[model samples]
Target: MADEINRAPAKVQSALLEAMQERQITIGDTTFKLEEPFLVMATQNPVEQEGTYPLPEAQLDRFLMHVLVDYPDADAEHSILRIVRHEQRAKQQSAPVAQSLVTQAQIFAARQEVLDLHMETVVENYIVELVMATRNPKAVDPELADWLEYGASPRGTIALDICARSHAYLQGKAFVTPDDVQAVAFDALRHRLVLSFEAEAAGVTTDDVIERLLSRVATV
Candidate 1:
């Protein structure tokens, strides 16, 4: 996992993502395959954007979710303080956190379960419509045409479907629904979209555009 991934140069970002996509590392003329259950979690400091290089759309789309984590609420902050003190105490006592955890095989099996979850035709259609809307927002609403520089690729459609299913699975559901799609749409598509200068000038974000798209695009 990388912190301040935005600090990495363009070539470094490219190499990293290439390794992720190929699931292999290359040294000289040799390539080595990555082990199963490979995952990369990265963090970007939004407030410290001054020196950071903005990740290109190609690199951004490599991530399955672009969850925006914000500061904890008052109660959560107090709980965090308690957790820190508890951690210190645990360290002093040489206590470990919980020992229980899922293995790679278990995680892979869960992924299989998500793949097996039933997705109805209309829900699939809804996902397609949402992606199509991004590509051709004017087809959905005229004003949206000014907001997008370019729509998401077909890859976005696949990402949306898989993420929606993953969402439903995580929620302990056996079937996928429009709500499942809605729950994961923002994180799935936020980094995929390329906003227009007009959108930026208007202080609009991809999240804002995605919200509008969700409201307008419906299965019914």
Candidate 2:
């Protein structure tokens, strides 16, 4: 996983595009394919951060999701503090590290099961329409018509389906639902969209547009 990727140079960020999309990175004269279940997790600092570079749109599209990590609440922060103190105490005592409960094979099998989860045609169409709305916002609401410079690509469509199915599987459901799609839509589609100057000038954000589309789009 790449942390604070926005601190990397433009060329360094561009280099990751191929590895992320194809799961292969070429070095010298040889190209190597990553093993199964390969995933890339990159964290970006806000553009307003000092010395942070904005990732190009192409590189951004290679990512499946763009999750915004908010600060934890008081209760969660207290838990985190306690956990860190415990770890420090354990390290001081040289306590043995706990063994992993899940194995690589188990993770692979779980992926297969998530892929096998069933999705109905109506839900599939709903996913498509959600992506389509990003492209043609005018159809859903005229207020959103000029808010986007570009919409999500076909990759967004594929990501929405897989992520929704995975969400259902995690919930112990055998079938995908419209709610699952909506739950994951913002993260899956936010980075894929390019906002227009008009939207920016009006202080609109990708999340705002995504929320609007979700409310406007019909399930059928």
Candidate 3:
């Protein structure tokens, strides 16, 4: 992947994909059947162009989420500042916020509950329509048809469904909601958009594409 990214040329990318397919190179191990749903989480710095190969659209589509890490919030920043000040005041002082609230067992239980969240057929169709609209915006809202370069993949639908359940579990709900879908949409669909060169040149981003998709694709 790194080598192909450095090459950047379309031909190089095509050749690399072909080689992987021919060799059946598992980018990573699959614990289940080939048809089973799988999710891959990858990280890349959008600002860094040095030595890093930008992921191709096809490769990016394989990822289930593209989370962008931000800096600490105001409260966290204040706490960090207090720690630093205290450290400077007394060398013996240690940093604060050293407490573990949830155990590994608790997290495992939470995941189980998330899996048990009910997904009605209506909600399932809603998820599908939302993802489908990304590919063919004209079907949902004609105004968005010209803004998109390419739509998301089927993997996106799976990601949305799974993450929605996870969100509902966190919220102590036994059922998924439209809000749950919205909550996870950005992370699930951001990387799947294949923006046109014009969109890129215009400073449009994946987030913009996702927002448009959400507006055009309605819930049940």
Candidate 4:
């Protein structure tokens, strides 16, 4: 279900990622298919990078997103403590089965609804332009010329479109907008970019460049 991939060696990581992409594993004489709704959520501990090998760009592209999470705030921490204490106290009594918010069938159906959500022509163009800018940042923003070594692949373009649709669905909206695209651009594109030495020497992050691109890319 979940793997702490940082503990694995480079060869292991490559094999695991290959499985994630193909949704199947092959042995000497036979192959097996992964079950439906099969998802592999991988995370690495942020503390150290001692013996682990970093994933390459091609392998990273197989993932749909790369979200960054931070420590919970005081309120959240307090809530977590309360939940733990409550769970401990409740162990003496029989607990009912937890209800799922949405089922697999519902999710499959919702995927269609999300696809049906209207995206105007201009907004679709905006999504393309945003990814296109990554390839030729200097054309729109001169400063970005020295910041990037290479741009995202065509996978980034498709990611921007579907992710925006999902964002709109989460918002209870029936349409997609530039704002929806903007909401997901960072997570969808951050891992796909390769920055240059000039950008690294100045402590520039992919987020910084993406933020600038979002601001400068034209919507109309």
Specify the highest-TM-score model's number: 2
RMSD of every prediction: 1.8, 1.5, 7.0, 2.2
lDDT of 1: 0.89
lDDT of 3 by residue, 19-77 (tens): 43343324445322332122233345544566556767776665557777788999999
Top candidate, metric lDDT = 2
Better of 1 and 4 by lDDT: 1
Output the lDDT of residue 105, model 4: 94
At residue 111, what lDDT does model 3 achieve?
68
Off by over 4 Å in 4: 47-49, 88-101
User: Against the true structure, what is each candidate's TM-score?
Assistant: 0.92, 0.94, 0.67, 0.89
**Predicted candidate 1 versus true structure: per-residue lDDT over 59-149, tens digit per residue:** 7888888999999999999999999999999899986868758888899998899999999999999999999999999988888999998
Colliding pairs, model 4: none
TM-score of 3: 0.67
